[model samples]
Target: MISIPICSKGCPTGMLSQFLLSRILENYPQVITNKNVFTLLQNEEFYFNCYQIASILKPVKELTNILEARNANLADCFIGLIKLGAKINQIQPGNQWKSIIIFNYNRRLGEFINNINILAYWLHPLYRGFGLKQIALNKIYETASILWHDLGNSEESCLNLLMEMRYWKRKVVPYDLSFNSIQETPMKWWLSINVQENETDQLQELALLLFSIVPSQAVCERNFSMLKWFLGERRTNLTLLKIESMAKIRSYYISNTDKEIHFRNKNLSEDELRKSIDKSVVTYDIFENEILERNENLEQENLNRSEENTEDENISSTILNINQFVNLTLPEFLSTGNNLFESITNRSNINERNERGNMEYNPISLAQRILNEENN
Candidate 1:
């Protein structure tokens, strides 16, 4: 469907509309070849009326798209409605079209737009420009009076909110920051600066509340769609915690990693994680073994330093026991270090004898076997 802003500034709708009309007029008689249909298409009045109506409804279509946008905020909705209202007021009746029709349509649209609280527009950063206009400014002040009593605050607080709003409009907010490209929301921007300057500003909090309201259900509807896709048809029985976890993951995570996700289990260790993982999980045994070896060596060096400080024979015997434990674990670690190249390129009978299953801690034999394998 052709969206609005179809007739927005610099749009090619005029040329495209002309092209469409021409194509329909030229192709109807030849392509359709039906007398009844051709007779209907031949009506110049019908085509001209359609063209005029399309031109008139172009801005309305753009307004609808803007309101229905998922990312549109409360401020954006008010700003868009204000622009739409202005565009409607500026529309002139064509010679053929009835003035009553245009007037009534515009009136009805204006009335509907009036239902949106003027404070919404007044609070928005972008619409402050529109609020300064004679007609809109009066309406904004009038709306503020009604909303002031409803704020349930002391008269002093209400007056302060208005004063803060005026300062923001005249001094703080710039014209260009109204665009959709702005990364920070109006409330966030205010809070960042306001908290830095004075943390207890009640007016800043009030303004934040006013600006935080969304103009439409577009964001809610989008989240609902995401929920449906995440759960799928068959997973209707999923737990709420699981569903929420999945939703959060979908929102935050862009890619998968080998790291396991843990919640509140702080004491879990690497060995526990390894044991819990599926046996089919691929292991980079060589890399893991190298890390383990480096860690063990560092521990040994630290222990040796402690032994030097003690000058005790018992300490030296404890170090010898630690070295034996390291050797015992190293064989199992190396056994898991499967190399494709070792299997394919180094198929020697001598090494096959050396790779005896679950051998006792024997560093000398292991070193000799490694040397033989490297020679081959």
Candidate 2:
């Protein structure tokens, strides 16, 4: 239910009213339906007395049964004004007589609302009671026309108008008036149509559309909001896959929730990336007799430099591992196989000798430190 502050009043703006109406319709369809909307007629006095938009309505209907309506006093008159609306054709001085109202204490009253609504064209406020019933009704027909263009009965639906007042007893003042001449031209101009604007149906349809969106997404969003509430400014340690999994799980159980994850892993890690990239580096050589025979010179120099055939073991291990990494860690790079980490971390090369006081630690940082110290 849309709870509004009970204070000095007026109908809210169109967009805000539309939004509120949608929310209400979404949550409470059965609460307010076509049948009950007319129940508003039970309180017409509020409409005529307090409705400020009387300026726009041209004040066609008189406040007849004032003694009968609750809260009919002028202090809360605006509330009644909100209950009613019509198209303004022009502004007449003040014949504000009742032509018709839909519900009646008796048949006389129902006929009264309908007639005044019909003659509503004659009652215009001098300033802007400009849009009368025909224009108002035509607005509805025009909108419905968008939805029901296939119905195919366009000609007879035009607004047929006439001038029918005696000179001495004329109700027309200085408001804009329409005549039968409008329908003479066969064009589809809105003013030319006799349709009266009744927006409740259109508004109801729109409300239905808005409500059709599921509660599940909203629940998901709320859950996400709660999750974010638990986590603070610090970056979370979850990988994208884990975070996504959590989001999916929340959606599966909840309705009308939302999640707000902050961190996105986009950049590559500094330690693993190598500058000189070549596709061939990742490709595995099967350690065939031919490669061993072909690189005899390179193998001899390697053996002379380090008594540990460990270097060759490391090289062999590196080649074997690269093929594995290409196949397993990143099959996409299998074509190029030029990854640097795979090239450098050879099986034999991975061993560490503690040059400092006989400590044999697996020092991954040793090579860089030694090279830097020697250079410095």
Candidate 3:
């Protein structure tokens, strides 16, 4: 696959090509017997086509590899996609091969990449729609505005947030947008910039949200695999809480460097130690017992509360019935009887029946009435 781009040109511009030609000549002379066929292998145009294909696809392949990584999150791929798109756009025109390359490249891009992903790419600290044409920048800003508005912010507020972010990027950040060092991850980088200092709370929040999102489900799929391994045949009946705890513990150990200690243990083989430790770490009876105890306490509390509520309801019912009996008589004049009834109803603190399903124009009731008339 690595050799694909240089297939026609070969290493010395002739290495692999020469080897394949030699093999054909030695063992399959009849395959290329035609004069045209023989000349085609040596054709510069054919080699250039292969090179063009290779060059154009290389970045796409790299982006796929990055997204498929188990631990990779959105920030990595967002940066990568933006860079790849820029590189694709930079392909020189006026050349026939360049046009073909651009068209094929764009067609593939359109098939997979959508505006949402592009918006995410453009929002990155490294890009922030900088260096992009005004049209592209406006599109990115429009999409971002829609996203923020969808998340419950008003359109005006969303636009204001974008404007604030642009200001922060241009004026607040000490480093250039194209900073290549990138010593920290996107989240860490934004976090290091004190949220209170530059009034960057909103911008930092956006960056963290974007950074936390993953481009692919690879991390999720990997975690699922871990789940399967931990909850083997023996632990199939693990409760949701237990499973959650175990997963968190496993993930913590993995990220905290403690899990790597096993690798450094020379005396015990990894498999042998893992088998011995599995019972203690994986079974985790203490956590299960604590969780069970906590649940029991909560259930007891809920039962007591329900009993108290029932007693209160009994007292309230008695009081309500007596009050209703007293208020059932007609007014002396009968002129303001409606107001009297309203006062009595308002004074009673009873829960109302849900009337939503019994609307005046209920279709279900109308259908039932029609069916009854038909049957009659």
Query: Which candidate number would show the highest TM-score if scored against the true structure?
Result: 3
Residue 162, model 3: lDDT of 64
On residues 223-262, what C-alpha lDDT tens digit does candidate 2 reach at each position?
Answer: 6775664343233587768777766764553332222322
Kindly list the per-residue Cα lDDT of model 3 for residues 1-376, writing each as its tens digit: 1131254324434336555665676667777778887887766676655564555466666667767754455545534544454444444443355644444444354454554655554555544544444444445545555555445544344444565545664555432344322354445555555445524344455555655665577667878888877864343588889989988986676465445665545676656655666765665467776777788889999998986775554432211111111121223212221111100001112222222221223232332343344337
Residue 320 of model 1, lDDT score:
18
Cα lDDT tens digits for candidate 1, 1-376: 3232356566546556555645665754356667776676656665566665554465566556655654344455444444433433333344345343344443344344551345555555433434233444544544453454454444444444455555555655322234222454555444444344322444455545555554566667878886766643332587889978876875553232233353424575645643454233334467666777788889999997875664442322211111211222222212211110000111112111112232233332332343344337
Question: Could you tell me the lDDT of residue 220 within candidate 1?
Answer: 74
Arranged by lDDT, best first: 3, 1, 2
Model 2 TM-score?
A: 0.15
Clashing pairs in model 3?
none
The model with the greatest lDDT is 3
After aligning candidate 2 to the native by TM-score, how far in Å is the CA of 20 from where it should be? 38
RMSD of each: 36.1, 41.0, 27.6
